[model samples]
Target: MPFSNKVPTIYDPRIGSPMLDAEEANFEEIALKSLGGFVLVLNDNGEIYYASENVEGYLGFHQSDILHQPIFDLIHSEDRDDIRQQLDINFHIPTSSPSNQFDIFAPPNSKYLERNVNARFRCLLDNTCGFLRIDMRGKLMSLHGLPSSYVMGRSSTGPVLGMICVCT
Candidate 1:
């Protein structure tokens, strides 16, 4: 099934285990393809849990090759620290807050905070291409109690991260 931007609806019948609705599965694929990028989901430890198939076209690595691997492993060494810092939840917490609690500029200590990153990633298919520049936009996802079927690989019982990366 293709990925969709909508949260897949779990359909439960009296005779079967819950399953994703077929209609919503293609939304993610359409969204990603339109953007000309791929999606990545990572555990708190930064291990890859899922990578869209389009990654092969953009980064030259098959999805299987990077699954269960550290995302940092594929990042250019010089850019690893920067990417790590941007993804670090602690780094986003504001040290001071505006006098008004409702200020939009005030960073919220919430799981939904979004992160943006620009970095260079190693190209596995062609070493001659060296590293390719990538821009990523994503948000911290709280997946506690998320059904195993909703995510790829192991079931996530804690917070997970997700990103959409485009090559430039």
Candidate 2:
């Protein structure tokens, strides 16, 4: 089905177990898109499995262009160590632990612009886009009993199955 901003209702079809009912799901999808945001579903190894279409609106790169790429490839090299540190923290958190949030900021410095994987980052569109400073807030979740898409993963592995990464 085409992605929509409307909330999902009871009648909406979800491939596996549903996280939100039809209406709520639709509403969230819509809200995220309306806010010029998109979602990414990544495995423990930091490989992106899914990239919502709205990513083009936010990053200027099409979803197709970034699919299957390691998320770190898009990050500034100077910031990679920090990202790794954060990912390590996420993986160490047990399933029973409370939800945690992390903030990663990339300034529009030469270091950041020099590492842009896509040329689009060279164009300063706005504060939110291009090499201007991008702030990412990610929630690291434990996938003990979620959908197979999250558990079995695109490539089956212990760490990949145990982690759920949602980035906006």
Best by lDDT: 1
| lDDT score, candidate 1, position 25 | 62
Give each model's whole-structure lDDT. 0.67, 0.49
1-168 per-residue lDDT for model 1 (tens digits): 433355556645775554666666677677778877778876555667778888988888998999979889998889878777765555565558443343323365453357778878887666548788888777756545435655556454334554433434
Clashing residue pairs in candidate 1 are 3-28, 3-29, 4-27, 4-28
List TM-scores for all candidates, in order: 0.62, 0.49
Model 2 lDDT, full chain set: 0.49
| Model 2 Cα lDDT, one tens digit per residue, 1-168 | 444544434343565433445556466556765655456665456666677777776667788988878777776556656555544433343466453432212242212111111211222236554443354445444434445665644453333321233333
Error at 116, model 1, angstroms: 0.7
The alpha-carbon lDDT assigned to residue 65 of candidate 1 equals: 94
Worst 10 residues of 2 by lDDT: 110-119
Best by TM-score: 1
